[model samples]
Target: MNTAPPHQQAALLRRYQHRIHRVPRNLVVQPTGFCNLDCTYCYLPDRDDKTPMPTAVAEAVARSASELVGGHHRKPLGLIWHAGEPLALGRRRFTELLQPFEELRRKGLLEHAVQTNATLIDDEWCDLLTEYGFRVGVSIDGPKDLTLRRTDRRGRPAFDRIMRGVERLQHRGVPFSLIAVVSRENITHPDRLLDFLAALRPVSIGLNIEESEGVNTERHPPTREQAIEFWLKVLAWSRRQPGGTAPVRELERLGRYLRMSRTQRADRAHLSRVDPLPTIARNGDVFLLSPELAGITAPTYNDFRAGNVLEQPISAILREAHRLSYVGEFLTGLEECESTCEFFDYCRGSQAGNRYFEHQTFAVAETDYCRVTEQAPVLALADTVRKERTT
Candidate 1:
């Protein structure tokens, strides 16, 4: 934790408020909307669609990369294959899909990554992923008993297939990060979850608290206090590990924020004119702010599309994104959080998708999602650091 004096830290945080940028940092690409397993809490609306992105669409997106991220002066934009199981497209098609980004990768303007359920990993897939130098993130809830929510379309448990894939990756010497969703059944059992995750020896662990987003409306284990307690337990459990095995993702972010130097904090940016993260659908439509809004549609918000990369360049779409009502409302929400919320510096405005899904509007502040994901973790980590100092 940062040991700077209290007054100095407060002064630095106030200055950090102005460090906002409009540059696109992450481009989430959906190779296909097909997923092998029907996870119960999944927010995706088009997970059944097997239509892969046309090669032309990929070329178009690649062509606009330099302009979208402000050219080579800025760091490489993170090109993440997500929104569905990217690996489900199979090795041959996935390889062909990657061809368009080769020049961008060579130019150091793009970094490739994939987030998958890991139920289809094989030696061929591993070879392709390793050849392309793609960072992998596997989605697994926990042990077999806890992962009852992750099942196939026919209601068969997917734990065995998922582990088979994970073991194959381990055998291939491929490093991966684990992403788990903590639903009502597993939120109260952090110890078991952490222990199981640590045994996998992943590079890191990310936990997404079960949310009432998209079509999944049945909220479970709903309580602010329970969520906070769960996070505090997670922080305590992570600290007890030797060398912090598979460090909890939320706490790691908090630690980074707390330990950043004055200069580093000042260099960080948010509350920008445009959403820094953009998700490109299989057909080339672009959705700003939230990847969860890719397949979702609402008549009031022009279906939540900024523009289609197939019709215009990504730079043009982003340049005029503010004109979109939802985008403008999201910006307003950011301003409200910046002026009102103490945790604004941490989560920026908590996620625009959550605001819309929970309240049907993007111009709102203080949703249950932010309280659990942003506020609780910060409070838990701060309390831990304070206790350590006194000891």
Candidate 2:
């Protein structure tokens, strides 16, 4: 049990039935716990475990996902092959794992993508990805020196190998996005990072600040001023795209808020704008909302594993899991954001895992995460739009 105050537990359970959501928008399949690199800040607790997901789990999830996406065309249900070094699965084995997902894609029922460190992307891997129309995402942190923490087991720098992988993708003309984890080191020089990425000419960029999760607990979150400046500068650099630059997805999303229609803004019923993203761990343990939420256990919460796909369908499990006490804790946090946060309409309370890690409760609002990711960019862009209107 959580052993928190009884009042706290009671608060979380109030009218919990009202919060049951539909099938998730994204389904993340964590096929293995093995990763070749040793990023010092990695939050995944299972990086050392080499257990690969059983083929049965993937089959079950694929079958369930096929049905969900097939029936509800507008749920935005998709699959993400992530949670560890996805490419490490190797081409042949990965293809088998991707069998169900490819079927979903072929039938036009779902979209699929792989978030890889891009270390093991051979020509064969690229061919498979491109053939299936997978929008691949490469994890990199710009220059070699800046990525000292993301090294291999032999303590070698990962920059060269990752860049080689990046180069391979470019050479093959494979469309991909760069997913960069912004930390204290890279946040200082957004320009150098931007320049390096622009040279590669990625399809897009995703910036994720170092979060206080799992073992990455000791976070050195950037200051409000620093975050504001970095995002704005990055946004400005991205504006030079007509000349040449990859679009930053974070800035693009923030920019969308500036131009949202009343209908778009007011449709708060689908809050978070999507149901919890589901993460099926290697062992068929299902977790919803955040893939990062997998492999962690605290008092009373359990793994938040709704059910195993081998035994039951995901939709059925999630529908029932929605009524669990832990879900109520998170939904209360959502209510907190709605009642208190200025950015509640924009962020829908941020990630549940982030809240529990930072605030020790899932029902709180506004962390350094919300400040840097949701508030800063929107404020920066919204301020710019306001200034343009005045001028």
Candidate 3:
């Protein structure tokens, strides 16, 4: 490594900062810290705390949302309510939690969504959901057996109840998506997984593999070949079920790759779905990057609370993030990925939280998470294309 002057190094970093700019419009809120179920591989450290979000934090989020809508490079501002279990707050509390975003949503300036375990959604919840027209994402690990880790507090099976909640939503004509955690058991069983999810008719299917984060110490990472095969199987199944199942996220990413390749736009080559999302804890703390980082900690960054919007302006927090050494290193790592990684155009550089949590440093190029998430899916799609050409 060249030992350069501090100012010269700073200038060098700035020259490549464009590859890592972040102005996240989506705000993920942990409305409450109470859940009826206790998943075995949960990453949240305070899943049992019953305290709800202070009114001040909600107000700050609203202010932040208002500020974000006018940003130069900002995407549409979205308020995503997620936590120990957002549904456990009940309809009334949940509605109260959404008060800050309702006005923005009505103004057609904000998008509001929630992620729930789907065990507590009754007819009342469905009615409220329909009334507000809020987007919901249901958390289920595909089939019943695949959900062994996602049981109720008593260690009893919660899949049936979760399915019931899903049925309630379906009967009421409420739109929702499915978010399945890819465990060791489910990662190898893509056919059964796709069949189960396809039967649900959700708006979309999202996969979140179990990995090391927060309190979770181990991750059952898939082999690169296993990941490629599973994703290819999902893509193949998606093509056959045009009208039956929702669009899978992995397939959607592949779709993006196809279009990007066709256009061959170099400027947009290194873009992810969005930049690092800004997450707010129930009390008022604010953290940027991956939503998982909101609950987890890092040695260099501590709790990773860049700044609290309650104390300072949201813009100020973002500006002050310039000082975080890890943030700088994360940016440098992104520049490295952009210059070196073949999939940089599609995935940007994977998520900061994943790299930091797994490799314990944000300065690294890539981690095991990127191997399956960013590389495998695209490679699978490319493999299909090669096979088609040969045939």
Candidate 4:
């Protein structure tokens, strides 16, 4: 479908030739979709089933994962335990699911992490997480009022539970991070949000702009100008905080740019690591791009089984990802981007789901995400750095 001229295609091929054989370092595993709290803006829609992966299935996935990474010169795999709440599988099953990966770690094959809503965390959970050195990322918006919509099917506010979970993690001295979903209701009070998170003092912070494809489609998505304004305010607040390691998302982009320019590390870009950043669901289905695409059924199938790890090799899975027309477009965009934009070295381009939702194709130009992620923040950071140097 992409009909670029021969010369342009040749140049693009040369630029990306260095990246042809790169293997992924991170893999997201969904134990189940059995989350306790039901956030309004959740991208995963079918969270009611609450089915846990059988121990055998989890073992097979771990074995396949080990084989995949082992074939790639034993590159360390960062296994990210993600879900409707990975903790919903409970501690015992959770431990069981992670055992094979722990064995791989013992063999020096992989690393493990768990991303949770923190509503189910306890001292025991904290102890297990700390014992395994599992990096935990808590999902919280801002404050009780802002997170009022984060409730259960019974319409009970989960703020108290989540806070209790955070307290346990803090008390146990477990290293963890925070992930906040920014929406129209919360974007106006950026300073308040930052201040609230600052009190918790997370290792890092990730702020995601609300997308319209999931549970919150009825809610108004924030405009690009509004999101930019919110991020700018947050950046100003972050600069004033002393001894804080909480890397704001937008500021991290600037930091990533600086690091890439100085170090020339090809892996510094966000989503450019490699193909098939594996996202394995509870039923053994492996999603290629991201976990957000879990519930989206293509025109043919009714369920979210993109492919199964038990039946296919990881290399074949990655090949399928490469064959996608949108994947090619996304790669083309990245290859050409650096010529016109200095920040191209840092951007991994927009997430595939974002492109799919906004433009109906993963490979298309990221006009929406670019408005806030690329265009506004990079230019502002460049200007500020230039002004400071000149001054």
Best by TM-score: 3
lDDT against the true structure, per candidate, is 0.81, 0.78, 0.78, 0.71
- Give per-residue lDDT, candidate 2, residue 348: 60
Clashes of 4: 0
2 against 3, candidate with superior TM-score: 3
What residue pairs are clashing in model 1?
Answer: none
TM values, all candidates: 0.90, 0.90, 0.91, 0.86
lDDT of 3 by residue, 1-391 (tens): 2245789667755643455345665778888878889898888888888888877788888887787776454445777888789877777777776787778778778877889988988888888877776799999988888888888889998999999999998998999999998867788898888789868988889987567767777656567778888888877877788575588987787787678779886756445433556788887888877777776655557668777778876666765565666666777787788788887777778888877878877788777788888888888888888999999
Task: Report the Cα lDDT for residue 46, model 3.
Answer: 80
lDDT of candidate 2 over 1-391, digit per residue (tens): 2344767655543434344356567788898878999888888888988788877888999888976776574734678889879778777778888886776777677777888888888788888888877879999988887778888988888888888888889999998999888888889888888788777889888888778887787757677777888887787677765754678888777656555744476645444454667789999988876777789876567767777898889878765664555676788787787899888777767787888778777777778788988888877777667877999
Model 1: per-residue Cα lDDT over 1-391, one tens digit each = 1235678555433432233235677889998998888988877888899999888888888877766655348778889999778888888788888898898788777889999888999998899888888889999999999999999999899999999999999999999999998877898899999899889989999998888888787756346777888888998887688974777778888877766634465546542333447788999999888888887879888788888888998877765555567765676677788899999877767788999999999888889899888898888777777889999
- Assess the local accuracy of residue 172 in candidate 2 as a C-alpha lDDT between 0 and 100: 94
Candidate 1, backbone clash total:
0
**Model 4 agreement with the true structure over 227-263: per-residue lDDT tens digits:** 6677667767878888755778668767766766787
Q: Which 10-residue window in model 3 sums to the lowest lDDT?
A: 13-22
Best by lDDT: 1
RMSD of each: 7.3, 3.4, 3.0, 4.1
